[model samples]
Structure formats: C-alpha cells, structure tokens
Target: MKKTVKILSLFLIVLTVMISCKKDTDPADKDFFVGTYKGSVSYNKSGQSITSSDGRVTVSKIGETYSFYFGNNIPDITGVKFEKSGDNNYVSVGSGLTGITINASSLKMLVNKDGATWTADCSR
Candidate 1:
C-alpha cells in the first residue's frame, strides 16, 4: 500500500508540473499577430481610389505567408511574406519604399504592387 501511494504521488506531481508548464511562443509566430485592426485605409488602382476612415484590416497567417484582408471593399493583399524586424515586430519582405510593419497592437502598410497602391494606418 505504501509503494502504491508513493507511485500515485509521483504521478500526481508529474501531472501538476506538466499542467503548469506551457510552451514558449515566439512573437514572430502567426498566433501573436493575427487579429483585426481598425483605422484609416486606402487603395488606389488605375486611377480608381477607395478610402475609408473606419476601415479595418484582418490579419491572417498560413504557413509562412500572411494576408491582410481590408474592409470597405478594398482589395486584399494576400500571400505576403514577413521577416522579423524587432523583438515583437515583423516587416514585409520587399522594397524599402513600400512595405508593411506589424506588431501585436498595430499595423502600418504602404504597398505598391502590380499598379495598385494600398495604404493603412490601423491599430487594435
């Protein structure tokens, strides 16, 4: 009976430790940055422009690619790759003039690609 009690205690201790411990998540991971931000957003393409002061951008990630889904009928920017920029920030991998910066609380984008320009200054 004493041996059985010791084994049960050991199992309980191990179970408690396992339950208390959590895996460390990297800030650059998709789960850290996927959310919705609201603010101004604009898009211009081929002389047509759309702007909204109450715009929203929903960020989603799949594998290594991140997508920005713009509200107000603005076109979505999909399959963009980002590189870690700081402790908790990621920036789009592209030319210096047009890129995106994203963190836990904010997102800023100024991208011009394929004759379309998209701008956003949003925060959660």
Candidate 2:
C-alpha cells in the first residue's frame, strides 16, 4: 500500500509539471489581436472559376477565452480559435479550421468554408 501511494504521488507531480510547461510554452500575447479584420478571398475549383468577397472578421479576447467570427450578411460564424506559434504566425482551430496568417502588412487566410485557403491583404 505504501509503495502504491508513492507511485500515485509521483504521477501527480509529473502531471502538474506538464500542465505548467504547456502554459509557459504559449509564447504570444493574443490580447492585442482582437478586432474586426477586413479582407477578401478567391475561390476556384477546377479551372479559373473564382469569386472574391470583401468580408469582415471579428475577434474578441476576454482573458483566456477567445471568440472569433466572420460572415457575409451577418457575422454568425464563431469559435475561430488560434494558436500563436511565432511573432506573427498562427493557425485556426475548431470543428474544422481554415488557416489564418497575420503579419505587419498581410492578414490573410483560406477561410474554413472555402475549398482552399485564400490570402487577402488587410490593414488594421
């Protein structure tokens, strides 16, 4: 019984360490990025048939809970989460994520609904 208790204690300690490491490794401040981003995307399937739209995407950051949205008539889309990997690098997450890339001069991504990722240059 004593040996089993020691093993359990060690396991708990390892788990706590892992959780702390995860939090520390997320090395980006996702606070300043919450805003309405305007851009456009190109859609093509087989040939050069494509359509582009000037749409708006909004991001709201309330502490650790980040909510995102994008749409045409109404911004009904939500839960566009991102994991910031570098100084200006990110990717989307949710039921299905379309990659979003942000930089000093470019705010582009192939939206989740699109057949492919489209990059539309935007301004703050």
Candidate 3:
C-alpha cells in the first residue's frame, strides 16, 4: 500500500509543523513589567492640584491579573488586567475610575472620582 504510506507521511509532516509553530507573544505577557517604578506625581481636587517628582509605584501579579500600588497611600488599584497595546506597551482593561498605560521604562496613570483626580508619570 504505497499510496497509504505516502498519505501517512504527509499527515505526520503536517502534524509536526503544526506542533512546532509558536504563537506571537509580547514581553509584557511574560512578567517583564512586575517591578517598582518611581517618578512624578500629581493630584487635583476641587480646583486645587498638587504635583511632585517623587512618585513611586509597584506592580504585582497574582495569577494572570495585575495590581498597582502607589506611594503616599493613594489607594492601590487592584484586579487590573492588561492587554498589549503596542510595542512593549500595555493598557488596563475594564477598569473604572483608574486607567494606566505602561511600557518597559515608563508608566502613566489617570484617575478621576468624586471631584478628585490623580495622575502620575513614572519610570523604573
């Protein structure tokens, strides 16, 4: 059954190729961003805003979700899930009142709630 043997060989080759192929993955998907960053911070409320260059932030992952903790007790934002937004960049998904955009070297945050706002431009 030479024809049967040939068909089996082709099927095996196709299976090997399918098994060896890899999916496109981003570095941010591989825990490249779990760390601490420090830079500028700003907060505004009721027509008054305070700014400083001493901001600090820590990023942690539990399972597949990420959490952002800010210095000065700014209230940690939790349960944020990120999706790849660009080259080395990630943005939060389905988060209310808090939004973050981050790359390998920098992060920016904007939060608005109850007539108050907070923003940070930070870097590792």
Candidate 4:
C-alpha cells in the first residue's frame, strides 16, 4: 500500500508539472499573419510618391523571409525578416530605421530602405 501511494503521488506530480508548462511558439513557423490587409498605404522614392486610401497589403512567408505585396502600383517589399515581439506581435529585423510590426489582426509599416519609403496602416 505504501509503494502504491508513492507511485501515485509521483504520477500526480509529473502530471501537474506538465499541465502548468506553456509551449513557446515561433511566429515564423506558422502563417498566422499571412493574409491581405486593407487600409491606407503609400510609397515614395526619389521625387515620386504613390498613395492610396483603399490599399491592400498581402503578407506572405517563405521560410524565415516575408514579403509584402502592396497595391496601387507600389513596389513590393521582399526579403524581409521578423523577430517575435511582445506576446502576439512580430517586428521586422533590419539594420536601418525600418519599423514593420505585424500581428494576427493588423499590420503597420513605416519602412525606409535604399532611398525608398513605404508606409502602411492596414488590418485583416
């Protein structure tokens, strides 16, 4: 009876530990943000600029890289990488002053690279 009690207690302790543990998930491993967002989007390079109020930005992921397909004839932003930020956000990784924050419901971008600027405020 003592041996049975010890075994049962050990099983209960292990089960409690497993139940309390949380799994850490990587955002890049899934396409949670891979969809089309619609709102305002703009792009500027040199002296030319393009803006649209009814714009769309499609998010796609291939491996660890992400691409942003913009509407309104704006050039697409490709080869972008992101790191997980906060609990449910992914922010772009780059050396420049690029800021692209993405979540399951929204996408915001103010990226400037290679003398070009892209701005977006969109939601799925």
* Top candidate, metric lDDT: 4
Per-model TM-score, in order, reads 0.71, 0.45, 0.63, 0.72
Q: Mind sharing the TM-score for model 2?
A: 0.45
What is the TM-score ranking, best to worst?
4, 1, 3, 2
- Candidate 3 lDDT over 1-124, as tens digits, reads 9999999999997775443322232326554335676888777777676677897877666556777787875666777777777677888777374478876677788877677777889876
lDDT of 3 at 115: 72
* Alpha carbon deviation, residue 124, candidate 3 (Å): 0.9
Clashes of 2: 2
> What TM-score does prediction 3 earn?
0.63
lDDT of 1 at 46: 92
Quickly count the clashes in candidate 1: 0
Candidate 1 lDDT score at position 1: 100
Please give the lDDT score for candidate 3.
0.69
Q: How much is 21 displaced in model 4, in angstroms?
A: 29
Better of 1 and 3 by lDDT: 1
lDDT values of the candidates?
0.77, 0.52, 0.69, 0.79
Residue-level lDDT tens digits of model 1 in 1-116: 99999999999977754443223323255333356788999999999999999899987765777788988889888878788876888888855334899876778998988888
| Model 2 per-residue lDDT tens digits across residues 46-124 | 4443434676555555454445455443323345566666676666666655566554444566564544433444444
lDDT of 4 by residue, 2-116 (tens): 9999999999977754433213323355643256788999999999999999999987776778889888999998888888888788899977636999876778999998899
Q: Which of 2 and 3 is ahead in TM-score?
A: 3
Residue-level error in angstroms, candidate 4, position 121: 0.3
